[model samples]
Target: MRDGPAPGASAPTQTDMDLDLAPSPPRVEDLIAARRAKRQAILAKYSNGTSSTSTPVASQSSQAPLPALLIAEQSITRANSVAMSVDGTPAPEKYSQGERRASMSNSPPPLSAQDTAGDIGADLDKLDAADNLAFELAKGDEQDGMQAPDQETISKLEGGHDQISAADYDPSRDRREDEHKRLLGEVPHKPKVEDVMEIEEIEDVEEEDVDDMFAVAMGEPSKKTKKVKKTVSKPAPVLITTTALLDTAADAEGYYSVILGEQIDGGRYQVVSSLGKGMFANVVRGLVLQSPPEAEGILGAEVGKEVAIKIVRSQESMYRAGLKEAQILQKIRQADPDDKKHLVRLERTFEHRGHLCLVFESMSMNLRDVVKRFGKDVGLNISAVRTYAHQLFLALSLLKKLNIMHADIKPDNILVNERKNLLKLCDLGSASDASENDITPYLVSRFYRAPEIILGVPYDPALDIWSVGCTLYELYTGKILFPGRSNNQMLLLMMELKGRFNTKMIKKAKFQDAYFDEMGGFESVERDKVTGADVIRKIHLAKPTRDLRARLMPPTSVKMNDNEAKLLTSFIDLLDKCLALDPSRRITPREALSHPFIRG
Candidate 1:
């Protein structure tokens, strides 16, 4: 009460703040009453705390009431602290309540884990009760002083229902045990000896087969190991087999480990020097150094390991390019070993300069670079074109069998080992097992793009055939068919071949104003379907288009004789099939290989 309301406190105004402090919510009294009842129930339920085996606790309610339980928990926590302090250690279960005055007040015994369990709720309460009861019973057996019985003593506490007892009980100890067992089965046990024996029996196999597998996993041993093992190795031929289509790029000078992955002393070996750089990976010249015991004397000196090391680049930037190429090489090698009639075979993979390198027969030059420089358009007679084309098909057939696509099948990626009399299809960066559902890509140079890619149509191996057609076209006329600056123009030039702008193609291409409109009234036409977008028709195709058309004109330059022109027109016809406006009508890799132009 403030000393007589100050004169300034005058008359209260409507805007003045007021106060009325009232009693707490009636719920608080209800909660206190509930807690008192629970305390009484505790004394009754666990009147003779005692037990033998840890039987689960039984409860009348599935879930315990809260706010009342929380208050009891706070009281117990404070008791535990005070008891522990007075004892200078922990509270004794048999402490005299009156002697508790010096430190702990004349209060109840401190709650143990069991008491806290009850506060924690039904499940924990029983758990704590069972454990605490067990401890109390054991202590009573050892002490002469009066001691409380464990929960099992409840059975003896019968009769005299009106009698008051203060034994404590926490429902947590027993409930938790029953809940755990009910939710999960008995703990799992480890397998015995009999299980181990069953697994071992199944693994046992023939000794020779085991040895063969071991020898394959580990390369031929050093001389010391060979002598100790008393095993002899035979040499296989340098060229296991040969294919006219594959051109090995191996040089016989000598091969050495070039680059080591990570540190020089550890990790992978990668061939660095004497290494030739290709469209992607690094290649080293080397020889077959040794043979396995099984391979010994199998062939003559020719087979004694003189080979070229194709070091796939270990640099992360070029990893995709290298991995794809290596995967393709390994796959082809697995398909046909001795015949060499298919794709280039990888003799084996080894570490050099930290990179995993492929061993293959080497070739001197690639078909693309060779044809681009030395190929005479005038001499590109049908027979001449057929010779190259046939070799290509053979390679294609072999590659198809392995499910390998030469995604970057430009002329340069193809090689012809003249001395070895072989042609090899190489480079598979964007390639993958065709079953992977991923497209190899429009990675080829713009001029070599298949019509579908330029037209934004879905494609697959059909793209490779388009590249092949482009290569053949260059070989025959030394001129590109749709040599536009970019993919968009290439599409326009392709449309010119058809004499009109394909409306459906335009829709698919989704070009803004870049589409070349060849139709006569292109300027006056307005698209009705497209909204908020400019309907462009006339696109200025790149200048290269003009040059390509000039080169393709009949009776062309002396560099391209009539015979070559005849070959070129046919090649152009093939290119047209590959660049067909409709993807479904496009030529495929397998079918293109069978065309008379490229077939042997």
Candidate 2:
């Protein structure tokens, strides 16, 4: 029944029609108020136990909007129920929505209608509580400028999933909160210096007590804490000296300062007195605290024994020379085990304060002291000379047998007993093997130097015999027979007594040009009286001015009897053979030992 009567009013526009058909949009405030009202109504229903149970599941699902808080509460309640089951039964497998709906349609209800209504009511109560908690939390988060906890966190909390327990406590979250609080000036700042001092103090306390604690725990007696004090040792004071004599002070030059009464060598030897000093070493008499095994039961060797300790200068050259001397002495000791050869015995060798020290048997005095005490520039008795000469020949024979050269031989180098009967050759510091070619030309003292040494001729054990000849003459006469102040004077004096060098000897001499001209005349170096400068001049001497035989005779102050004259003649003959100008014709130690002067 339509009378389609439209007129005048502008035909309804398309927009006006659409607007009339559309429903009015709800305001945000109205929606929020409605939600709150619904929540309160649900909460009141659950609290009064008067919620409508007549509502079917389908009507509830279709008509009522699903709220986030209600969904979360249902999920959490189901999870809690499954977790709290004590039957040890497996939980039902989860199903997709379609599968759940289909199953619900086909299967019988797992619960009674009343029980399902009660569960729904309980779930609504949980939802209300969760919604309140969320609202409060969100309000706090907004004030703090932080995001509120998400849906998952709310679910976990409603399920009572270990809230605030170690499993749920986040150390990182706490750290972040602490950092935020510190940035907001909620915590006081600590000073770096105070922190460092506190840490150091703790470490010191631990160090002082850790050992004691460990000891006590191990059932050991606890030790008292000891405060360690560091000590620094000051160097010995330096001594200054102006004379040529060496100082006892330690120096950078490697000289060990000898302190009197100081014990050295591990307290085995105590220095008693300084015996003597030389350019290369210092000789000190030491009291042996413990006698060496080798010295036991020997007549002159015993405990509390006195030994001459020769401490070599710390210089490298002197140390090496001292080492060589020790080796040679060891060889000598091995060669003559019976100690019959009249050579000084090396007791031992050791190092003390960086200096090589050699210990030897202490002798009463040297031959120089003998000459000074008994001979006194005149001469020793013929009987005494005969005894000493016999012993001297034995020592030379031993040296020749061993192929060793006593490069230094003088009265000062020979040692004797207090009675002057026992004699031993000592001071082999300059001695070398006979095969050594690098021998020093200025080895022997100038007064006792052999003629071949002055001529620079290659020498052998015979050179030692020449030195022995010169030494014997000095011992017998208590005077240096050929006392030359320099090498030039030494050669001149030798030529004056022995004779001019023969052509054959001069041709082989290494230093012949220095003492002789090309024409074979003596070129002597003499001091000028006016200038005190050396001047070389040629001298022609056909023969020796003084005979060695005459030189060996007793001094004019002494008179010889018949027996003395015969002994003197034999002694002169021995001297002549030893003092031969030509080393090749010189009498050897073995030959000299059998001479009438030594054997008879």
Q: Cα RMSD to native, each candidate?
A: 40.9, 55.2
Residue 171 deviation, candidate 2, in Å? 95
The digit string of per-residue lDDT tens for model 2 on 435-509 reads 984424465666677877777788888888988888777666555656564556678777777777788988987
Shift of residue 420 alpha carbon in model 2, Å:
1.2
List lDDT for all candidates, in order. 0.42, 0.60
TM-scores vs. true structure, each candidate: 0.44, 0.57
Predicted model with the maximum TM-score: 2
Model 1 TM-score, all chains together: 0.44
lDDT of 2 at 117: 40
- For model 1, the run of ten residues with the poorest summed lDDT: 223-232
What is the C-alpha lDDT profile of model 1 across 4-75, one tens digit per residue?
A: 322545553321211101111122235436544554454334322422322333452222223223344444
